[model samples]
Target: MHLAFLRDYHEALVIALARTRPTIERGTVAEITSLTPQAVSKVLTRLLDDGVIATAGVRRAALGKPAAVYRLVPESRWAIGAHVTRRALRLVLTDLAGTVHASATTALPADFTPDDLLGRLDSGVTAMIREHRLDDDGPRPLIGVGIGMVGPLDQATGTVRDAHRLRHWHDIPLAELAGQRLGRPVLVDKDVTAAVTAEAWRRDAGFRDAALIMVESGVGAGLWLNGAAHRGTHTNAGEFGHTVIQLDGPACACGRRGCLEAVHDRAADPAAAAAILGVGVVNLLQTLDLGHIVLAGADLLRHGEIYRQVVEDAVRTQVPRADWLTAEVTLTGLGTDVIAAGAAIQVLNLRYGLPDPVGLRLP
Candidate 1:
């Protein structure tokens, strides 16, 4: 059983080591993965046989002996990720190790239907796969399709509950529909939640616990806790942008008045949402006590400094117990590509049979 656990961790380690520096020696992999030298060699042999890795070259190290380096082969299977936002659909294709290979974005027509979107997404993936010459039907290179969409999704039914922008999109079967068209299994999730899942396994800061708040065309958040992403009951727990802030403020497109989205039109312009988002975000800071709220998406990053200042001020004012809620509300390092990168991460995770982020129900 212990070896079983190490077995999974070992595959992930080899992929990680091969990616970090493009090439790695056996001794270096041992240090990074914390596995013994002999154990690392055993794993390397298995990986090479699987065609996931290949030997780069041998280098003389000052410590003990010379070591052979390993690199990721260019042709190990791939996973496809799709992001359907208000006006456009973004696509990302990546390898088993979650490294992106090709990406494309297409504008979505205003009078589009669920069927229309599915067709476009399917064709996009097909064209991209063929263009990249990555199809061989060897072992199912395409793991699955992951979608990052605007939400209030019913996980059980895989339906889109009322969306502000996608008024025509309601209770539509996304995963099954897309799956039928693409000939693969599909995972549909909120865009922000996907972002949270993508960012949690950061090799840099290594923040295992954090919250990702995105003030975009809509506002939402993805929470990461205990090395897992947290989704609440109904899978829409992080719907903060829609929470009512003003009962009599402005009529939201969703038919609500003074809601976080009503006053904050971050989608219209990110600078606008900063004020309204700050009001409630401060309250959440003191309540969750979890540090590191990530401000991502197109809108928030547009007026990043303003959003940062407003949230920071609110934290200082509301969380009187601390100077700044004891957390850092920041931006995502991935920029616009996050949606695709995150989706790719989801694809790899599902392939490896890893646990879904905490709080997300497995429907």
Candidate 2:
């Protein structure tokens, strides 16, 4: 069993490397992943048999014999990612390479219930599958569905413990419920965390410590720390909006006073809203010492330049010795579809992405 697990791990590691590079040879894979040549050969054989990868050609160097080169077959797997916001349900179809091939969005009913969401999800997924010609007959079948939702949820149990402002979500078993309804496996995670995962997957390894600050119907921060998603002990880590920024200030929907979301919502103008969000970003930077700050969400993207400038100014002016502790602040490259795309990538990661090497060290 241990050997089998390690074999799977090595296979995932090779696939991950192949996704980044144009072609991979056995020696290169072994060197980068610290896997033995024999192990790489075994993993490569299995991947080739499974059609996950294909031999590109032969590489011959001046010093050694020709070596077979392999590359990932990105279309070898597919997943559906759903972003369930307060206002809409956005879905995307992503391949193994984390590329969003097709996407669709539909408005949700005001204060939608669990039943309402499931109903729409069932129909939406069917339409997406049919429209994209994503049938089970393909070389890469649709594996599962991943949901990026409003949080205060338990990722471990796949339950929504209590989504802050959503009335119909309390200890809701979303993963199980959606799985049963759609007849496919399901994975659930906080929206911000999923958004950050998408950013990390797309940005290469340099985006180790960062925050995806989303400002849509509400505010939240998705944390990517030490090259992985950082969900707190209860998986409720990205509740940035509820953080008390003003004592005895306006009452927030979460039953908190002077929350960052509340203050930003009550701001008189877009500039004021951006400034409020900027202060929150500074607080996150102080706590995490992040390398990147990605601003996203439907509401924020509407005024993208403003939010980007304000947050960049805050990081430059508010943080001490800004030159010494520079943090890159920019808008999300994926825009409003980030969370949904990330959710899809989360599904792919669960199945094929390599585990964090840091977590694999012996105690």
Candidate 3:
């Protein structure tokens, strides 16, 4: 590895620690990151000088010299995340620590077009910036914008290859278009991927090998494996809704018959729908051997407890040797804000979080 890249990784690791840990010090950070004391000292000094972190006073040890504690200066930078749902656009402004400081939502037109979305995005983002008084020239400037939209889209090129159920979205260059309109750097990703990223950020190292199942306008699963968001070969991984569950089932928007989403959506009641969802989740667990399953999305949250119970029951009863193949299931604590907040956190991750270890194998 290049020395410069290694230095960048060390800095990102330290920043990640400061974001998640309540208190940070040289000894603990070095211990956790496996960086030598001297390297840790250099990283800390640089971060401190850059105003990304600040001293939180001192921690005294009876045997050794008192070590200075540090904490992330969350307000030093900010990013806006937008969740582009079928009915509305949900926006959240988050800080470097990934804490959502403010949120807003605006309704979209029926079967909205790229122009429609771009217009709304421009007005909405401008309003947010003005309302929050987030001066571009201020000490704490807004970093960028991130959009979490329904997908089967291309994350690598920031283009929508073909967003299921939305006609105008095909072949749209969302990231570039939004960036041009908003006058800020932009990132576009599947909504489920964004939601899972938010959960991973919140859970820290404990979030390894997990999936975030979302059920709003449709069903999809966001995958986080080996400590990172798994955006498969085409960067279009989270199309969990279209997975075939029934051979003679109803037709789906993706031109598939008996897809999980189609079957679940046709169910009579919330309980029935949830039960259908549970089966798919168990299938996911069986395939991935996931340790955590987080449930989110507005439609699902309306009957959150019912879905949670159904999914938990499925996990307990369906998978073989349930005792050994246990998976914790729960609703996303962020409620409807999960995807939007995750979008903003994605921007933070790009700017100040850990570098992706793409080809490295993990234990």
Candidate 4:
């Protein structure tokens, strides 16, 4: 119960801070949350005492008493993020202020098994910890970990249900294996989902409800809402690649004709701007009602203009809903390295705590 309540209160505090930027009066926080002024005062006091927030100065209304304002301390704790792909793995340790502290990567064989991947992950974590100069011993009581990997992921089971990029891979035990080995809570998300998570956490444009679409080696999308990934009933909500976009477009490996994946084949179609892309984007955007679109992943970037033009053109023509027009589309901030940054950031988060300036307390 304490844990649950702490999490809820933490979220409430985080939401309030995010919406208002750095500094806010206790009264203002109360007004935004519709909570009693006294309650807000208590939370603020705790935040200040714990160093999560700090008092800045006195604010004076035209004819009122001076006000004490609180702001996110700017640096509190930090997080590690990791992104895993068929060819390589990337990791980064970040400070609470969205600053990258350390980073590294290693090549991954296309035929590696789940066990093989986990072994590399263990080695990577140990190396990252050492590189980060984590305390005299190591990190303890970490925040959380977020992982980005090739999907169809079973979030509940922490398994990769089926990944085409890796040879003979299905139902790979990723979450359980990593969590057990690392001794920290692990969050499993598809590459796009983890990218969205990182994007939201690091940027002002992050959606209260949003979607991230990656057209890389494999086309996949990730869904995030209310500051967390919406893994859905079956935890397979964003498998848009499997949805049929063009009934007779092309044959998919799933033994289907015209699935989004087949239509958006990055390698075969040098020109990714064919009619098939329009159908997929239009169908996906309308159904998701997402307010923003982050176009990322390596394959799409490789094609560059071809990829963007197809998506933008499709969105313009297919989306009849006026509200959908406002959905902002932008290239990922980190571009092709987003997954790697996201992955490394996830590990850092586990070591430090999301946005906690205290990061891993490297010796």
Candidate 5:
């Protein structure tokens, strides 16, 4: 079982490498992964047999025999992801390569309940499967559905434990319920965490230690630390909005006085709101020392330039040493599609991507 697990991890590692590059060769894969050539050869053979990768001719080096090349068969797997906001359910279809192929949105009733969400989720996944011709028995099959939702939730149990501002969501076993309703496997995670996963997926390894600051109906930060999603001990790491920036500020939806979100929302104009958000961002920088700060969410994107500039300025000017503590601030590349697309990618990652390198310490 241990050897089998190792083999699977190696395959996943190779697949992850293939996803980042256009093509991969045996020697290069072995070198990059620190695996023996024989092991890499065996893994390559298995991947070829499984149709996860395909040979792409051979590379001829001047000193040695030609090395076989392989590339990821991205269309070999598909996943559907849904972003459940307070007012809407946004769904997207993504391939194994994390590309969004199609998207659909349906507005929910004001302060929607779990059942209302499940109904829309059921219909949305079904419609996407039908429209995209995602057959379960076909060569390229739909893997599962992923949900990026509002938080104060437990990702480990896939349950929503009273999402902030949403009255109907307390101890809702969303993944299980959605899986039962849709007749497919489901994975649920906080929206900000999922959004950061999308950014990390697209940006590759260099995106280590970053924060995705979301300013949608409320505020939150999705943490990507050491190249993976950091959900904290209880899986409720991102409550950036509730952090008190002022001791005597306005009362927030979270029932806190002087919270970042409340102050930002209460600001007179977009510029003032952005400046408030910037201060919160600087505070985050002081704590996390993130290399990248991605501004996302509908509200922020509406005034993207202002938010981007204010945050950038704050990072450059506020963090002690301007020259040494440099950080890049920008808007999300995926735009509104980020969270949903990320959710879909999470499903793909669960199946085809690299497994977490934890708990197993090999000699």
Candidate 6:
């Protein structure tokens, strides 16, 4: 086994425990990680030396020697997340503990290009750094940037693959461009996916299988399946709006007939729109059997209660055996800031999150 891999895995495990619990002792970490006390001691020493965790004095007991306690240093690192929508760009600064410290939003010109977004981001990030007085030379330094945008984009390659209704975004290497402009690492993901990540981060363990249904300028679903963001093989899975609802009903922006978005967009009123969206939600429930459905996005949130009730009622009545297979429907707790905050959380997760067990190589 590579010593580096062991170190990272152990460090991530301890950091995760420290974030949730009030304090962590070497023995408790050993018990949880199944690592020997000696191994846990080595990991703790490294984490303390790196300033990722801090000694929280000692916990004395009636038993053996007093064990040293440790806690996550939330401000030990920072990240900036940006939510790019058709109308505006929202940014948030988050600490290692995934707390949003500050946020700001800027308007975007209609049909903006890749360059347009990069300019706004460059200025906005510079302003945020200055405003917050985040020290680059400090023990806790700014990490990198994460961008969540409307998609049909490739998260792996950070390429925008023709975002519906946005003409200038065709096959743009946004992550590379933005990274060059901002002079920092960048991560790009679907807006809804990022929003769902934020929801998962804030909620407890029960939020494993869920979907964040967003209806801003368009409709999309962010899937959290089996405790992770379920980006499809192509990283374009959350194109919920384009799912055909009515065969030969109406033409859609993706050049399809009878899309859910087209019908909802053409609805006579918010009630009718909510009804259309409710049908889509039921379809998703039947397919995924999700435990939670979160409604978000500016357009949907304008009539948040109406949409929430419609989805909740649909899940209650439309799904067979609804009484037994209950699905919780609610609005996003973070409101409009969900995507940006989630993007920031992604950056934090890159550094401190646990390694995927499925991907880990066993000797």
Task: Report the lDDT of model 2 for residue 222.
Answer: 94
Instruction: Report the error of model 3 at residue 113, Å.
Output: 1.1
Residue runs of model 6 more than 4 Å from their true location after superposition: 57-68, 135-137, 356-363
Task: Give me the runs in candidate 3 sitting further than 4 Å from their true place.
Answer: 358-363
Candidate 2 Cα errors over 4 Å, as ranges = 136-138, 356-363
CA lDDT, every model vs. true structure: 0.73, 0.88, 0.89, 0.65, 0.88, 0.87
TM-score of each: 0.81, 0.93, 0.96, 0.82, 0.95, 0.90
- Top-TM-score candidate index: 3
Tens digit of lDDT per residue, candidate 3, span 66-142? 99999989888888999998888989998887788999999999889999999998998899998888877588688
**Models ranked on TM-score:** 3, 5, 2, 6, 4, 1
Error of 3 at 36 (Å): 1.0
Worst 10 residues of 3 by lDDT: 354-363
Show where candidate 4 strays beyond 4 Å: 2-7, 15-20, 97-99, 135-141, 203-206, 225-228, 266-271, 274-276, 303-306, 321-325, 340-363
Instruction: Residues 237-305, candidate 1: write the lDDT tens digits.
Output: 687877787777877776778778667873355454676677777756756777777878886787778
Candidate 4 global TM-score:
0.82
Global CA lDDT computed for model 6: 0.87
Q: How many clashes (backbone N, Cα, C below 3 Å) per candidate?
A: 1, 0, 0, 27, 0, 0
Which residue pairs of candidate 3 clash?
A: none
lDDT string, candidate 2, 226-248, tens digits? 88888887778889999999998
Off by over 4 Å in 5: 357-363
Write one digit per residue (lDDT tens) for candidate 5, span 1-363. Answer: 999878889998898888889999999998999999999999999999888899999888898798888998888888899999999999999888888889999999999999999999998888888888999868769988899999988888888999888899999999889988988778898999889988887776788899999999999999988877888888889999999999999988888799999999999999999999999999999998889999999999999999999889999888899689889999998999999999988887776666643210000
